[model samples]
Target: MLQVRVSTFSAKQLVFSNIDNEFIQLAHPRLWMQRICKRVGLPILSPHALRHTFATLLFSKDVNIKFVSILLGHSSAAFTIDVYADVY
Candidate 1:
């Protein structure tokens, strides 16, 4: 099992924000990623893809399925296993 130390952040803090420290519109990051992918000649990817990649990477490292399920806010470990059975 992988041991992780989790930290809590302020509820008022925004993970993604504009240069002015204001809330970013929902489409802003997607548009930015699209432009970056176009400039770099890479396939366009969505934010959800990063999330799946994160979970996959964690599973690849032998992290417990229950831990990952909790991190993903899944209702149960079985669901996580079902979704990522190929990873393990």
Candidate 2:
């Protein structure tokens, strides 16, 4: 967690506020994230990092790459394997 501080009455708030109860797009609030990390002590997260973590966690759980590839919407399981071979 970035552990960012806000002056809310509760002393805890979701910094990267969301809208529409939807997932955040990769480029959504990009500059805001950079500025927040610049102020906080957290490293800048790459756009692919979340995807990479999803794949890596699946691999760690012994999930088949073919299933993961299908879930990832990749053209082929082989391509997914190729891209995340290090995690395997």
Off by over 4 Å in 1: 1-12, 17-24
**lDDT for 75 (candidate 2):** 100
Question: lDDT (0-100) at residue 21 of candidate 1?
Answer: 50
| TM-score per candidate | 0.68, 0.60
Evaluate model 2: give its lDDT: 0.74
- Per-residue lDDT for 1-88 in model 2, tens only? 5554444454235334553333555576677667777788789875467678988999999998899999888999999989998878
Q: Give the top-scoring candidate (lDDT).
A: 1
